[model samples]
Target: MNKITIFHNPRCGKSRETLKLIQEKVSDDDIEVVKYLEDVPSEEELKNILTMLGVKAGELVRKNEKIWKDNFKGKDFSEDGLIKVMVENPKLIERPIVIKDGKAVIGRPPEQVYSIL
Candidate 1:
């Protein structure tokens, strides 16, 4: 089996659900949970995960966040700029990104992680 890792924020329901689903599919030992807020990734790591997710920086953003609205809305930023925002404010990054080997999925409905598994 492939190594599984979940970039989780416990406060989010979708992230929790994704964790539950992974438990059903595999043993706990095989799944690693990264509490992203406490174990924050550097800019380079975040960029690599985003690339594995096959999405642009915008797609991985929680734009509804007040921080995003207050600072980033109606503004044009380069890809690097957007990534910097997510690195600086982890909340702005989308929840429940599950990575398996070289592949990754955003567990939006939680079920989305199933495909990558």
Candidate 2:
């Protein structure tokens, strides 16, 4: 099997749910949880992962976050601007992103992690 990485946040319901679903479909030892908030990805790494996800930087952002609401809600920025924000504030990155092989997916329903498994 390919390497499986879950960009997880323990406090996030979706992330927790995604992990549970992955456990059902894959072995526990095969699943690697990257607690992204604590250990944010490098800019280059994030860029490649975004390409794998087929989404722009802003699309992967948690715009509903209080920090976003307070500071970034009204701004209309280009892709670079959004990427900078996520780099500066890891909380801006959304939860439960599952990466397998060379493909990446957001586990919005949690079960989505199984699709690429």
lDDT of 1 at 24: 98
Clashes of each: 0, 0
| lDDT score, candidate 2 | 0.90
Reference-based TM-score of each model? 0.95, 0.94
**Cα lDDT listed for each candidate:** 0.91, 0.90
Model 1 misplaced regions, further than 4 Å: none
State the local distance difference test value for candidate 1.
0.91
Poorly placed runs, candidate 2 (over 4 Å): none
TM for candidate 1 is: 0.95
Candidate 2 TM-score versus the reference: 0.94
